[model samples]
Target: MPVENSRIKGLYKQTVQERLKLVAKAAGLTDEHVQALSNHGELDDVAADRMIENVIGTMSLPVGVATNFVIDGKHYLVPFCLEESSVVAAASNMAKRCLGHGGFTTNNDEPVMIGQIQLLDVEDFEQATTNILQAKHELITFCNDVPSRMIALGGGCKDLEVRRLNTHMGSMLVVHLLVDCRDAMGANAVNTMAERVASRLEALTGG
Candidate 1:
């Protein structure tokens, strides 16, 4: 069921279960999605043990929904899980104010990010930087050497750079890998590429 209006008054007065049902109906969440949102959101003792290290337990937090959002002409009830109070109220209030102006819209931007490879104990920063620049094409190719859906979709290691950063420890050579991550957060892709190219970068710089 689609919601006719994003604005919903007195939502905070409802109980947690009541609010969950309301939001579930409004968003047309599947039964599985609704069940996942229940029981601390698929994050019980077993899940906690599998997810991270030294799992003691999972702490419960208040899950609040911020209503009155219309992005790209589609109504959405954004949910927030945090300890902070009044934040959800503030967001819902802001959405009501913007609802008169056709609500919020979206404009997609290229989601490119930079991943760094740190090289330490570089004796010749100038020479090392020069070597990296000369082999820029080769390094980029090496990063994208593995077959990937991201690379096939024209999003992968696209550019490279070498610079010197003076830290409290010493002046270290840093290699930046510019990657277009498409519609995803580039953490996994960027980090994997950086790790894959680390040995080569060290060899090139002799650091």
Candidate 2:
């Protein structure tokens, strides 16, 4: 569903709790979500340690609001967390200056990424390259066959490319898998696909 207008005047003047309530109501957020945001000390030592390596204490940064942003015909009050002064003010000033020209427009392509697999110690580079090219469809299908929620969401391997590289050690072959990850970052998905196809690639290249 499309978002309604975000032009909430005097939002920055309100207290933290009042601003949270207003934002929750405007965004159709549940009471539980609002309560979570309102609560302090939410991230204790245990939670902080679990989130990253080493059991160090948590750090804090000042979060300020930058107002008067109209992006794509929708107004916004962007929250910025930083230690430097005048950053938020500068951004708000720039955004207000651009409002007369339909604000900022953004364009993004499909979220596709490349996964590379390197093959070394090949006996015959020419024949191995030919074999991999011949089995391109099978390799792509193999990558898509893995149990991934991304594939169910209309995202998976899209194309394959092979390149031959000459290193100081010897000749090496690299296979590139082009995958569309939809809304995900796709690091895990791409790495898993590369790992799954490694053995088959070894057999084909006699690596």
Best by lDDT: 1
lDDT tens readout by residue for model 1, 1-207: 246666767776665556667777777778876666665744564453333322222345445667888888988777666556567778888988999899998897678999999999989999999999999999999999987888889899999988899989989999999999987787999999999999988888899
Task: Estimate the overall C-alpha local distance difference test score of candidate 2.
Answer: 0.72
Itemize residue pairs with steric clashes in candidate 1. none
The root-mean-square deviation over C-alpha atoms between each candidate and the true structure, in angstroms, is: 8.4, 7.6
Candidate 1 RMSD to the correct structure: 8.4
- Please give the CA lDDT of all the candidate structures: 0.77, 0.72
- Give the per-residue Cα lDDT of candidate 1 at 99: 90
**Over all chains combined, what TM-score does candidate 1 have?**
0.60
Please, what are the lDDT tens digits per residue for candidate 2 over residues 94-207?
876787777777779989999999998888988998999999999999999978889999999999888889988988899899999999999999999999999999999998
Which stretches of model 1 miss by more than 4 angstroms? 1-67, 72-91, 100-102, 105-109
